[model samples]
Structures are given as structure tokens and as C-alpha cells.
Target: MGRGGPREIVQLTGDRDAISSVTFLADGKTLASGGGGMVWLWDVSYLVKPLSFLCAQVGRSFTQEEWERYVPEGPAYRKIC
Candidate 1:
């Protein structure tokens, strides 16, 4: 047997005090992550270039109120207030 390097290509970190989980959207064009007691949507269509950083950085520093603003209806999929 031969040893191999890790195959992972992406990493995301955010709101250390409140993050719960991170998930990908159905189409893979976006990312949905939970943090600060809420979920957020990040555009990932530009993963081939620098824009991917924006998606990864999107939820890294959200406050509770800011999370609520982005995911106003709470952690569920429904978009309501």
C-alpha cells in the first residue's frame, strides 16, 4: 500500500461561538452554512477564481443580529419573518 495526501480542496470557518453546521445547496452554485444560531446563503459560482474567497468569508464574522438579518426566518428553509 502507498500513502496519499489529503484530497480535500475547500475549507470554511465562521462564528466560532455559534456555528453549528455547513451544507451545500441543491445546485452546488451556492453554499448554506449555519452559524450564530442561524443559516446563511453564499454564492459560489466563481469557485474557479478569487470570488470563492468571498463565499468562504461570507459567514465568518456574523453577529447574532446579523445572522438573523441574513436568515430572517430562522434556521428553517422557509423564507419568512
Candidate 2:
């Protein structure tokens, strides 16, 4: 998180999982998390827009091999990469 600034309004949590890696979009409204074999996308402006939300999954089930190479543990409260 940016902390104590205009961009500090948003915060992210891994819950019980370990955070591996985090990526922010160019617009700063979107964020991506990767860890425990799963990927998540979040909208930071959820308060103003009900549609804004966070989405998560347990690894990339579509590409088993690629998911294994990227995230081998499955989903976690926090990212590990």
C-alpha cells in the first residue's frame, strides 16, 4: 500500500495467506495479486461503485502446466510471489 497520501486510500490484505507479489494497473484503480497458485484482481474504488470488487481463483485451471510453473500451491490469503 502507498500509505498516507492521496493514493493511500486503498488497502489490501492477504488474510491468512502469504503475499507473494502485487501489481498495480496504470490507472491505479486495479490491482493484481499472485501467490499460492492463484491470481486475483481487485477494484480499489468499490465504495463508489458497487460493481467494483475483488475476484480470486485457485490457480489457472485452464492452463495446468503454466499454473504449476507460476503458482504451485493453490490460493492463499496472501500472495507469495
TM-score of each: 0.40, 0.37
* Cα distance off (Å), candidate 1, residue 70: 32
Please report the candidate that would top lDDT against the real structure: 1
- Alpha carbon lDDT at 8, candidate 1: 43
Q: What lDDT tens digits, residue by residue, belong to model 1 across residues 1-81?
A: 223544444565556567677777888778888867688777866664433343366735455666567544335333122
Off-target runs (Cα >4 Å) in candidate 1 are 1-4, 7-13, 48-81
Estimate candidate 1's RMSD in Å: 17.1
How high is the CA lDDT of each candidate model? 0.59, 0.54
Q: Please report the TM-score between candidate 1 and the true structure.
A: 0.40
